[model samples]
Target: MPAPSSTASAFLPVVPRLRSLRNSITLAANPIPVLDTYLNTYGDTIVVYLGGIRRTVLTRDPGLVQHMLQKNHRNYPKSDLSHGVARYLGHGLLTSEGSYWLRQRRLIQPGFHRQRIAGLVALMQTEINDCLEPLERQLAKQGGFVEVAVHALMITTAFRIIARSVFSNSLAERQLHRMAELLTAIQAFYVRTVRQPYLRPWQHARGQFRRHDQLAAELRDIVRGYIRQRKEASGPVPDDLLQMLLDARYEDNGEPMTEEQVLDEAAILLVAGHETSANALSWMWYLLAQHPEVVTKLRTEITQVLGDRPATFADLPGLGYSLQVIQETMRLYPPAWILDRVAQEDDTYNGLALPKGTLISGYLYGIHHSAKLWDEPEAFRPERFGPDQVRQQVPYAYIPFGGGPRLCIGNQFALTEMQLVLLEMLRRFDVEWVEQPAIDLMPLITLRPRQEIKVRFRRHKA
Candidate 1:
């Protein structure tokens, strides 16, 4: 279907002031409940007022999502709130907008090209095996279920792929840990600041912003050190992500990215790529733990595809069911749960007036779970993403990586990396949750599990 027409108004039924205040409070603490309550009560779209002054039009309409994200995308720049992220990540792809974003995107896009990323599959597999092998050996020694949190495992693996594969030896463990510290610190600050804007003065008074700036500077210096090393190295330069970034030039002036821009992009990828992929993969394992039948199906697919071998680049296509499982997991627990943009000018969409500076939150979580969009939308049904079913999917209905021009550049890399990691995990172990499901979301820079998910891994039997 085409994008939503401008003739249609945003948010079908506006939430009244009194109710909006109550809902707004709930949203600051836990948005999932608030979004669900209102989305069901107000149809696909709803107008919400935060603190009785800030109006956020939350919409799950696939058409409208596409309309703003793609059709008339220029009219809606990413919300100024990303400055919270910029405080840590600088003007990277995720936080940058306007001509700077465009220029930086062009410079960075080549690093994630399919061919380049394809070469990294071997690197990804090596890292996955490195992470899993020791765990498997320990599992064998234990001879039964051994509880281990998959979130940490996934996070570490993702970090290895990005840090080791791309930046290589330049990012030392100390610096990597520092990177994590900065990301966590900034995210906590950002989530708190955005959720409770009135608390900004409190945060500033508490030196939260100062600490964020300090950590951000440290992280930038770490990235810059790596970049400098690559440039100064006398040895033959490897054709990895860092090299690609160093080599990339602006299409117009043919100028290479400045060292500052390199640092920004590196910091962005280090955090965004690592966290999102890890979160998605961890959630997949969690879902599998809850759904043994789905795990069995995945096992069957993995067995049929790999036989006596490990999954490789060529094997990914045949691992269709495995990919479906990942796709379905993302649908249920999209890491980037919500997105917002500010209207650049006064406009009308289907007769709904969008005043300039209006913040529009494309409620991805709500849209993914909308009852009108799917049969049994709440159910964990991987078959829904099968070839035929995929054709029937409403555009913007499944945007784990977003869509249109602003679609995540590393989508291919993440998917392919996940394909290998998931297959390897399944083929090697029969996983079951040691603890209960990780259902509650800790909404921050990304949607994370409220509690870590513990899973017991035992060697798979013939």
Candidate 2:
């Protein structure tokens, strides 16, 4: 609770000693356990010093989180420290701040309009179904228990859908494959760089930075080439995401995005949509398999809504329980398990003041799992998100997609994709956990299962 360099009895309890190499090691390996310990032992406002210089306060208090992320959002600009992706992906929506971010958000916001995203539901379903052909073939050839890696399957399908939606189907398999490889590499390196900053010298010695730059250049070229193709497509510009970006003009001066800006946005779109949706669906499948009762309820709702047909946008509104299932799934395993915002100026909250440059993270996992907020916090109870039930929960307490102005722009798109995929999954097969895969949480850029989550996809009875 104590802000760094402040008076000891300054209206809040300090994380005594404020430094612990033991907890630091635990934080690097998996921050969840350490955070859980902090929540239990130190209570909400837990502070830690990194390398004996930077101060990071982990806050799980919902009202204070509301004040920080929403009430006084302007005072909490994103820290450059968390922009590790910019080194690999450049300054895009997720990394940029101030006027640049605002400009981009305004210009790009139209692309995700409800009608536009709703129109893509058919396109989304097509990509998922086409990708599943191979799976269906495998299910036939390999029999009941397909034992497929769920994360890989979901990512592949979601990636293709996003690529088509963004680039207007311009990316060839070769181009897509190369882009995928570079993105995966960049993500791995970015996560490592952020988690282990002291290893930068060692990383540089191994040419990690040089190699990442090269890969980034190639990815940028692929995206820029697609933008050029869209611009020169001859006909009236196709009504796709690429066309939208190309068409976006600043309200202040009517200036269009530069080619580099276009590439940055395109790259972020692909990276953000692919990884986030995949993580959500993978965990949903895992949770559904583990909780058969929820699955049964979900399946019942699916049957009542679609009645043996493939799901569509029209079906989503009626799929209330289905939506709740996703909501609850996210509550348990939010894709972005943590978010950071550096204090732009000294600010006080909940009787504690933070110094400028103090990195503040609303420990999302800790907040979502707080016993003070949720009943049976560790249990997977989808009904907790039922309309009436969720109304009682605080606004920032269940921020699966985040809150405030920085709330995910692709929120609608992700939900639509997830809804369609979940419908397809539930309708097509009887899901079961393969090999009793022990749940090992991987707190990477997204929350992912540590090991390959193999699932048995038996054909459901007709």
Candidate 3:
């Protein structure tokens, strides 16, 4: 209930700490609805106490998000809310800040370039095909229809694609599964600690923190072993992300990243590369199952462009509707749903005052769903992203991959991978809705379905 550092905040509405405290339990369970309720009640921008512990400004204002993320980004580096992940994930691009982050970004940028990702298309498709083999087998045995837990399937499929993309054949299947498990365990626990800051002492007393730290160490060891294998390998270097990181040399001194640095970046890539795409692809299937009309339109575009042939890197650009579906899915269930930034200095947007050291939580989910920004904001309409429609919207209102100078480094890579997965899966199978309980959102580090999304996939009849 104490006043903020600056009077500029007075211009904004305040959700009392007590109210946020009362809602903290609900917020911890699923923050999207709790946050949406707050935004819906108190304009687009307001101040609320996070976890009833820290007073912070929460805004779904596209202008404010753009201002913090793009316009004057230097004054608004990622807050501890982001850095806190480094305890488990390491200080890679996602958790790092300032000049070091810039350097790493510059060094790793080329690896994700259009030309580079284009080259990886075959690798991605091969992995995608491999992932679908089991489903194909199930359909064959079950009279051409098989029920699948789509979220679990997408998680496995996405992790393989990213792992192969990063380590190529260096990691064995067992090792890959182990790494995935460790990452998931660490991330899930980290989210619990963050959402319930009051439980830190209890978690620590119960040795949960120590156990997760050990898990993180094991993850690092797995990655480090692979990096060392690449370093000690005797043959031609495999064309993979690990190689790309190995070959990258800083512009100034022309020195490659150290072993520890490589481990940090590689771990970050594995964590970042898989989770968002997995969640997006999972949500994409969920949405498509409910809306067969949308799926039919998608098939039309695919057949027109690809016929019975598989889509290659060149064929992807022509598949516009597929990308729009992915875009719209992200709009509905953005993986990186909310972002946190802390002000390093006093600043103001329009008439609102922002004192130095202000903590701002840019609610991207709200911005994407704001009635003021979109007509029928809750509807799933891929056409909204069509060329003309996209230009009609406000900037930063549709930032599924985030925006500004620090835009997701792997945005193009994620889009290409998601598009390829969608095309390949639809081309091979018919995704049908399977009756189940209504799916609820579980907004952890990423937005996921609270329960398994069950869907039936039948072999495509040409």
Candidate 4:
């Protein structure tokens, strides 16, 4: 058998100062620059200390990532950070570990099947139109000079799509607004907790825990009400994700999940299903705005296929270039920028020994922009993902949604949502950048654009 790779301590020089609380806060708050410097200066593999904890950072080496995420996955479990994350997200698929995760995965996977997703195409198109129509009318009246943050619109778009897919017009406007507010609050608190370990004592003492509890309770009540209503209603069953979950049977005993399990999974789906996709779309529009040539080319392609028609799932195959744009955008600014795993047993990689409980940080943003893996790593180049090209690339080099058994189950859902939204936006409006916005890294639960991307939209002429 092959010997284990060397531990990080043996192969990479460690940044000792990062262990200090002050230094850790700085690094956590400003991760991209630090990460870029490390990957560029220290090579693909390096170890850093965060708050006295030794963490290994692996960048750009697809072989190493594949090994960690797939080949030896059992030896590396979800990290403690994930547990903290689950505290708010509940024991859903995103947060569940061990057999609980396995069980949840088995029960929930069927709902996201391609056939089921295809059936929701019409609904997605309607949501896209609903979001675009107002923007289009505004652009026409304002002569294409509107100061709109694309990210904000993308957030609402994602929520509408996911909400309709689950409850299908059942959610009242007030309830939807409350759901958004609660989710935003939870995300803000989560960012605080992750970045400020020192604040933990005071945060808990100040009833922050109770606030989280209240938020979770509110979300659970909303989800449970929907599930209960579906159960009580005696009519033709709908073909939505919620209904799919309602019908799914456990493999072990052919039993359905309890109400709590269903609620947890539903809430997770709502949050995860929307946040990452919205971030991606927001960044893509920003990139396209800066590169007008690329935008022009995309418009050409979109206009040809859409040609005075709204884009449907049927047009997806023909929107290959548009899809490539989204892919490249994700590569440059992956929403799930960092993935963490903890060593379950001693292991070695590249002559570095890793003890049990060692945390491994897969710096995906660093990897995606690594010079060794990508040429002109900082530039926007959608053709990199052309039909004849991507297969030749290394497997884990482009893990926007991640890899292995724990790969994002909603990968297809996010992709479909992006494609539909991008195509529809391009079909109805012309987006132009107001200015070259500063790109700052907000490394929380997901990486977000620190500065809102402002753009002016012009209505497309038939």
Using TM-score as the measure, which candidate wins? 3
1-462 per-residue lDDT for model 1 (tens digits): 112323234434667656766666667877788777777776677777665556678888888788889988999889877656887788889888889888888778878887888788877888899899779778768777678878889988988888876776566778777777777777777787777776778889999888878877887887888899889989777767878888998899998888888788878888778888889988888888888999888877877778858887877888899889989989998988888888898877776677787788998888888888878888999999999999999889999888878898889999998888888887778888665644678766677887888888888885
In model 1, what lDDT does residue 43 have?
Answer: 67
What is the TM-score of each predicted model, taking all chains together?
0.94, 0.95, 0.98, 0.94
lDDT of 2: 0.81
After the best TM-score superposition of candidate 3, give how far the Cα of residue 427 lies from its true spot, in angstroms. 0.9
- Top lDDT hit: 3
Poorest 10 consecutive residues of model 1 by lDDT? Answer: 1-10
lDDT tens per residue, model 3, 1-462: 333433467878788778888999999999888888877877798888878887889999999999999999999999988899999889899999999999999999999999999878888998999999998877778786889999999999999999999999888999999999999999999999888899999999999999999999999999999999999999788888999999999999999999999999999999999889999999999999999999999989988999989999999889999999999999988899999999999999987889998999999889889898989999999999999999999998899988887899999999999999999899889989998888999999999889999998888986
The CA-based lDDT of model 1 is what?
A: 0.81
For model 4, the superposed segments whose C-alpha errors exceed 4 Å read: 1-8, 18-22, 51-60
Q: Model 1: residues >4 Å from true position, as ranges?
A: 1-12, 23-25, 51-53, 435-438
Assess the local accuracy of residue 279 in candidate 4 as a C-alpha lDDT between 0 and 100: 90
Candidate 3 deviant stretches above 4 angstroms? 1-8
Candidate 2 per-residue lDDT, tens place, 1-462, comes to 433336432444445443444455566667678677766876786675543334567788887778778899999877766686787788889889988898899889988999999878877888888988887998888786577788889878888888888876667888887887888888888877776666789999999899989989988988988888777778665567888888889999999989888888888998988888888888888888788898889888877878888987877989999888888889989998988888888888765777776787787888889999999999999899788898898779899887888999999999989988888887888888666747788888888777767777889875
Worst 10-residue lDDT window, candidate 3:
1-10
Tens-digit per-residue lDDT, 1-462, candidate 4: 112235545656555443334466566677677666656666677666554344555455777777789999988777877777677778888888888888889888888888888888888888888887777677668774666878889989988898888877777878887887788788889867766666789999999989987997887788899999999999788878888888889998999988888888888888888779889998998888788899888878977887867777767878899889999999999999888888898887766677787778888988898777788999999999997889877788899989999999988888898998887777777778786648676777787888888877777665
Alpha-carbon lDDT, every model: 0.81, 0.81, 0.91, 0.80
